[model samples]
Target: MIKAILFDYDDTLVQTRKTRYQTIYKLSEELFGTKITEKEIDAAWGLPAEEFLLNLFGRFSSDIHYLWSIYIEFSKKDLNIPHLNAFDFIDKYKNFVKFGIVTSSSEKVVLRELNELRVDTNLFLQIQTSDHTAVHKPNPNVFEPIFALLKKENMNKEEIIYIGDSPADYESASKFGFHFLGIAHDDRHTSYFQTGEIPFVRNFLELEEYLIDQYSFI
Candidate 1:
């Protein structure tokens, strides 16, 4: 029945390259006293921010809490909207199904971008962020809370699908037995398609069409 669709917000909903560039550069300069290049930051984009920080900075004595505070403050100010177009078909179908955003980003950053983009908050039944779940993508624990939330609404796992732009997302969906849609075209997303573990679409337009076709039978 696929009563709901869960989305990954960063590279899936909006382009992530520029936002990563700005946030990484600003944080590196402030924390390390040196500017890190975009190329370096891009390499760390798919992983958790804290893991990325630790990898770059090593285990510093400073509490992770302080580092995250700085990262969030920098990200909020630097976030930029990328070239985005509405999945018009999905927009049309919204009334027929539930939708939500599940991302590795914090709620603050997600809310800020949603507000800036003027995406209707009412469109999503739930917004699950990394902060809400102790485990991030590639970890089934993150999906557990989402399932619990949806179960409370009488939704079954079979009646949901997850769409995202990374290999970790594909792995998460597989672990949870949810249909996975991998967003290809971006280099960051190519691994999912190349592995052929999940179906892939080039863009939202293609995804919208695929969904329309797939759901027509129902």
Candidate 2:
């Protein structure tokens, strides 16, 4: 009786790690004349934007805004197509449960990518982003807004699922009382969930199967 599903936008819904790595690589080279390596980016992956920058540069500066602008422009060129039948998955389950986007990304970034992918935003019951919440992931309060929304719909916490790709996503959702499903896209993500004994699926096809078989959604 899962009544709602809250999705993490970036790595979960769309394939963004490469695009993000490229953006950071090019930005570092263009501005600071430093070439950031993929290994470095991977280490900082899934961190909040500011924290990601801090982890990379080891310092905070006004240039973070400049970097963000360039990142957004680069992202505009990246289409960031939905991963593994994500649009199809949404369409298939929209009637079965309320769909929402609960992400640590800003609305500006999320909306642009969603538009570029041609996803029908109307299909979601809500799209809550970092801009909509005071705190971000790893902080359980980040889920309060959506939790409240579900409560208003008379949905129980046990009946809501939050699908994401990072340990932080799982931590926050589980702490906030929602079931969490990891959407592991690579060995790194896979290992994280496996180590934590968390349930996950590699792609939307697996997700579709998991939902039907485990939840009797069919």
Candidate number with greatest TM-score: 2
Q: Candidate 1 — which residues are off by over 4 angstroms?
A: 37-43, 53-61, 86-90
Worst 10 residues of 2 by lDDT: 58-67
**Residue lDDT tens for model 2, 47-112:** 666667667765434577765776777667656767888889899878878999988777788888
- Model 1, position 85: C-alpha lDDT score: 57
User: Once all C-alphas are superposed, what RMSD does model 1 give against the true structure?
Assistant: 2.8
lDDT of 1 by residue, 10-47 (tens): 77887766576777777787777886776666666666
RMSD of each: 2.8, 2.1
Q: For candidate 1, what is the TM-score?
A: 0.84
Model 2 spans > 4 angstroms off: 50-65
Pairs in clash, predicted candidate 2: none
Total clashes for model 2: 0
The TM-scores of all predictions, comma-separated, are 0.84, 0.90
Candidate 2, 200: how far from true, in Å? Answer: 1.2
